[model samples]
Each structure stands twice: as C-alpha cells, then as structure tokens.
Target: MEKVTISAAAREGIGVKGALSKIRAEKKIPAVIYGGQKEPVSVTVSVKDLDKIVKAGKNTLVEMDLNGAKELALVKEIQYHAVTDNPIHADFQRVSMKDKMDVVVPLKLEGTPADVANYGAIIEHILREIEVRALVSAIPHEIVLDITPMTINKGLVAGDIKLPEGVELITDAEAPVVHLAIPKEEEAPAPAPAADAAAAQPESSSTKGKKDEEGNLTKDAAKK
Candidate 1:
C-alpha cells in the first residue's frame, strides 16, 4: 500500500493535566509513536489531518514527518471524547518496510450473488475484515471479493480469498466471509384466544346472594 505523508510536531509535558487540552484547543490532537525497537515519542498532529486518515481506514500506512525526520507508522488506536465523539488521542505503531506484520484489511463485495435475485437469498457478509501478514509495502488497503456466482446456501471462507503475493492470511481458513442465506418467512402471530365474557366478569355484590322464586333475597342471608 502507498503511504500517506502527514506532518507532526514533537510534544512534551504529556503528564501535565492541561497539556492535552491545550493541544486540542489549538486544533491539534496528542499522539504517540512507538515500537520498531525505538523509544516512544509523544507528538501532536492537526485534528483535520488525523480525521482524514481515520476516515480512509485505520490500517492506512502513514509516513509521519516529525519535524525533519521521517517515520513509517500505522494508526493503531484512537480515543474519542465521550460526549462530543471527537478524537482525543491516537496511537501510531512504528513499522519497518522490510518486516512482515499482521494487520486487518477491510473486505468489500463486488457484485450481487446470483441467488439473491433468482431465489431471493440474502447475502450475509460475515467478516468485514481479515487479518493478514505482509510487509508494510505489500499490505492491502482493502480486499475485494466477487460473489456474483454464489448461490443460496453457498458461502466463501477466508481460505477462498485470493491474497496478493507476499500477503498471508492470519485469520482462520475456515472462518466464513460471505454467505447467501435463505430468507426466513415471518410467521403471523397467533390469534389471541377469544375472551369468555361471562367468565371474565366479576359477580356483583348485589347479586351475590341466592334469591327465592319471589325474587327476594333468602331470609337467612339477608339477616346476616
């Protein structure tokens, strides 16, 4: 994958309480670059630039220009504000072009499966991404799979994907990536049982006592 170049400035006072907030107020977010057998460096990058990379993909290979020095890295994690949802901080893992690393690449389906139209089968994308081991330069931004020929009940597993040369799948081979499923018919809810009006009604207090043929309450109960 081609690397995207982004500019960053070295930052300090990471332990200071308001230091991070001060960076954000200036339209930048705090970030750190670590790994690759080097000491971690604290830095800050423009919020706009970081957001663009995030929107493209987290696995996007980046070339961080820290002042005059250049470093290759991958966006590992991003912390967001709880209420505003804005990015608060980011972690970038330093990478080497010569070393093989495992990274997740997004999966994209190219076409509708045959069964979708012929049998009304629904296409289920079981795996949205897959982990693969490859050199930084060989890592793919996304993997596209063609599903046009698939039929109902048919599926494509991770092993079925055609990886680019030098890229090896790290995910399980048997793990499902896409499947054409039969749509389930929604059963009509059972009709509620008819209510028995007489059984449901409570006996009125006025009619609680037995009456004689003359329609007068029994004398024995009336006395009570």
Candidate 2:
C-alpha cells in the first residue's frame, strides 16, 4: 500500500478544546491515537500534511512520525466544525502490517453501462463504499467495478465484484452496488369537468336550513 508521512507532536498541558483551537489557528489539525494496548495519545499535525495524506482515502495506511518516533496508523474518524467546515479533530487506530483489519474502501465505477447510453436508462449507484478485511499494508484505497454490460433492470451486486488478492469483502455479497433503470415520468391528474364541479356544490336548501336554525337560537336567547 502507498504510505503518507505526517508529522505530529505530543500535546502539552493545554485542555483538548483549547489545544484544538490553538492548533486550528496555526493551520494545523488536532488528532488522537487509540486502539492496541496503549492509552490514547492526543496530538496535533499540520493541515497541509493532512490534505496530502487524506487524498489517499480514508482506509489508507499512514506513517505517523511523532517527534521522530514513527508508528503505523489508519484514519478511523474525523470531526469537522459545522460552521467553519474545518477539520476539528481526528482519530487514528494503530495497526500491525501483518494483521488483517476491517476498513471501508471507496467504490469507483468504470465504463458506462450500455443501458444508460442506448436505452435511456438511468444509472444509480446504491453504494459509494464497501467494507473489506485485509492486511494493513495490503489495504486498497478504492475498489473499481465495471458496469459496461448493465442494462435496464440489471445491476451489479457485491458478489460480482472482483477484489485484489488477500482483500476479502466484509459487506454483504448480495447487496446491490449499482443499478440501471428507466426514468419515471410523473403525469398530472386531469382537471375535473365544469358539470362535475356544479353537481358537487352544497345544496341551497341546506344553507337556508342552517340560517333558520341560527335565527331560532337568536330568538330563544332574546327570550331568555
């Protein structure tokens, strides 16, 4: 697997919120390392360093250098500030190169399905990513599937996927990843005819009866 080198430093006495704010202000991102037998370590890294590493995708194997001490880790989770849209925090799980780990890999569609071009069928991607189990060093960044033969009502399922050696799919084999279907056109209901509208109107006799009841109530109230 391709590796990205990211530099980080052990945080000092500052609290997590304060340290995270300071890190963001310096154009750096705050992160934590967990998993294995060790306590989680809070660290900070450069934002530019992360942008380059994140391009390798979420399941990528990352080599983290913490003040010169190196370790192999994988991106587990990332937290982003809702308003600022900045990466506020992240989690990295340490792993051994020889051990198999479960991770989600992005799905890449290759080749235009024939139905989409020749039969006016719309192509829909039901799954954007899939989980797989593989060695940390053998984990793939993305899985590519061909859809050239797909036509209307046809689909490609997880079982049809061909993965690289040593990479086993953790997602359901029968789950559909992509589907081709004809576009649905909605038709508006027809307007009611004028005769039907006239026939449905409330009877004038009922209105007159209602008015008579009101008049009787007013007379009774006046007598009281």
Best by lDDT: 1
In model 2, which range of ten residues has the least summed lDDT?
A: 206-215
The local distance difference test score of model 1 is 0.88
What's each prediction's TM-score?
0.81, 0.81
In order, what lDDT does every prediction score? 0.88, 0.82
Model 2 / residue 182 / CA error / Å: 1.0
Tens digits of per-residue lDDT for model 2, 62-158: 8999988887898888888899787878888998987999888899999997667787887799999999999888888888888887777668888
Tens-place lDDT digits, model 1, residues 1-224:
76678999999887899987789999999999999999999999999889778777657888989999999999999999999999999999999889999999899999987678888888889999999999888988899898898877568999999999999999999999999888899999999999986468754676564667775668765765
Give candidate 1's error at residue 151 in angstroms: 0.6
Candidate 2, lDDT over the whole model: 0.82
